[model samples]
Target chain A: MDPSEVEFLAEKEVVKIIPNFSLDKIYLIGGDLGPFNPGLPVDVPVWLALNLKQRQKCRILPPEWMDVDKLEDVREMERKEESFTPPPSPYYMELTKLLLNHASDNIPKADEIRTLVKDIWDTRIAKLRLSADSFISQQEAHAKLDNLTLMEINTTRSFLLDSLNCMFKLRSNMQPGSGTGKALDY
Target chain B: MDSQSYLPVPPGVGMEENFLSLDDILLSHERLPSRTECLFPRLGYLEKTSDSQDIMEGTKMELPLWLAKGLYERKRRVVSVELPKVYREGWRTVFSADPTVVDLHKMGPYYYGLGSQMLHFDSPENPEIAQALLQTFIGRFRRTMDSSQNAYNEDTSALVDRLDCLERVLFRMGQSGLNSFQGWEKGRASHLTTSALVLNYRKRKMADLQA
Candidate 1:
């Protein structure tokens, strides 16, 4: 599997951690982590943070956009536009899922966050379906895409390519019948 | 919540693959062996039986699943040569206590589709073969997602490669009309879009910086 957008976001996303113990700098494959104080908050990638949270060794501070109202606003924008700017992180859904799965207690209004994310996802998916419908109907070789994600691209790729290839094959087949090629063969 | 446990199983096509075209199959590096040799010779008359007409004493023949099963039932052990080392290992792993990741692509989608067609014929004797492959595939897929989730601190290229491979597998699965990936669809889709957003943001940021 390719590195998902979520993975990219997760790598870049820094989480505030209140560690249970002080430790020297730890080196990870991607980068290095610093010496920690017991009470002091240090930044770490969301992936490491989630692992620590799961281990009950540290507390993770959720990102700014994780709030219910903000997510609702983003959802509203998504619903209004054919393709609008997405929320801050590509890893938003994955992060939400991970945090909710591993550290729900650490997040305030976890239930509300879940509901809002679900609503946004549904709305966006519906829009994507509509776009895909139009894309199919248009039957053009090319179409401008707005705010298309890798998921939507992956979903539509085979269908689009197959349809286009079929259309081209049909066209090529028909051209032989309509032209001098038939007469030459005869 | 393990969302997978709650997914509505999509309607399964019993013995047909309609999603992929012949061209797609041909283009892909998926092919059955040119010839498959039968290990166990005919007990009665190799030359006399109606079903054994295709069988020659020494030469290998690439028999279809139906013919192969008919021969097998009659005690002609058609040696299964098409199954790759990975699949054999995967099958063994499914039986073992700890099963590692199985590369479904290496097993090949067309090959899997072929095997699925013969499921009805093969299942009576070896009931677990097909089910184990399917279950292990799902498990591996779930693990792929989990790995992606945990890959934040990993190299970007490796992560991208994993995601790219995943997208391909997901596409093939879609072609098969298998609802198995339903559980991961929302998350996968969301992850893709999120990446697009990040790219767009980065591009805009670069433009601003240039300005």
Candidate 2:
């Protein structure tokens, strides 16, 4: 697997243990994992976190930024911003998707978080589409952007690049003497 | 000219006629040899022995970005990735001079894409470095175009106009460096056993050589 895939998994929510029996510290190739106790919470990779949750050995703590109120605030901010706001984490969107799919049972207010994240995503996408429209209409040859998260850029890349490339062709063709020098130009 | 034969074939059809396709540009760019020192501990998955290293922790070994990224992500303790020499020097030049006068394409099409991807994840604090560089570059680029006092003949000016259009497209495209490795491309590579085959077949082929 690509390292990014592994890193994405590593950045997920830390799992909290609700231990039934005592366990010794376990070591893995990556690093020492735990001296797991009855009520201690430790950050863990998503794969291990999900495994522990399934075995009833641990309860996962949703990331601090994953709360319903926080997400709603982010959604509102995105709707109002002229440009993108930096996401809480570079992998915020992906982390949300992973947790929702694999550990929803452990999350507090999973449904609301889902909705809020969706709203934020939809609003930002709508903003991107609007900016693209204005760009084409105004025939501004260049775009200036800041604060876009990695995920937002990924979602808009195809549409943005395709439109810009199309505009490039349009601008070039509209030039005089396009086809046959003085007599013709394509 | 026959009016009946006139057809709107669109303009700028020849814009890239003499230039390499995006895919080709990426392929040749990938062929360049480079290396970087790893500043963290990383695990290595050995394909042949199928035996993996528990950790490669050090600043001693120099490796490519693909390998370095894997190790870095597994346990960022494994290796620290650095900006390669070509780009480091290129930026030094851009920063020291009027960015507008610098040719954005001097480093090649893959410069922004590869540079941003390597830096963003590995060096989180500077994720926006690529965009900042491009913003300055385009600012100056546009300024030069606006200030030109009929610097070239009509033919040359037309070519310059086309180049301006191309530069913008590339700059914007470069902003989303990681996009090239994600989405449709990722989907294609998901079939791990066949991905190598797919890549080989995807390369451009030229035929018809006569002595």
A124: Cα error in model 1, Å: 1.2
Best by DockQ: 1
Report the CAPRI category for model 2: incorrect
Stretches of candidate 1 off by over 4 Å are A1-12, A144-146, A171-186, B1-181, B185-211
**Distance from true location, Cα of A138 in model 2, Å:** 3.4
Candidate 2 interface CA RMSD, Å: 16.8
Writing each residue's lDDT as its tens digit, candidate 1 over A1-186 gives: 232443445556677888988899999887888678888888888778877877888988788898988888888887787674665466666567767877888899999999888787667655655555454444445777656554444544544454344234323322223322222221
- The native-contact fraction of candidate 1 is 0.00
lDDT of 2 by residue, B120-210 (tens): 2334434245444344433444333222212222233332342333444433333233333343223432343434345456445465333
* Least well predicted 10-residue stretch by lDDT in candidate 1 chain B: B1-10
Candidates in order have lDDT scores of 0.50, 0.50
Residue range B34-132, candidate 1, lDDT tens digits: 233443356325434435535454444455443443344313434443443433545546434333343344444333344343443332423344544
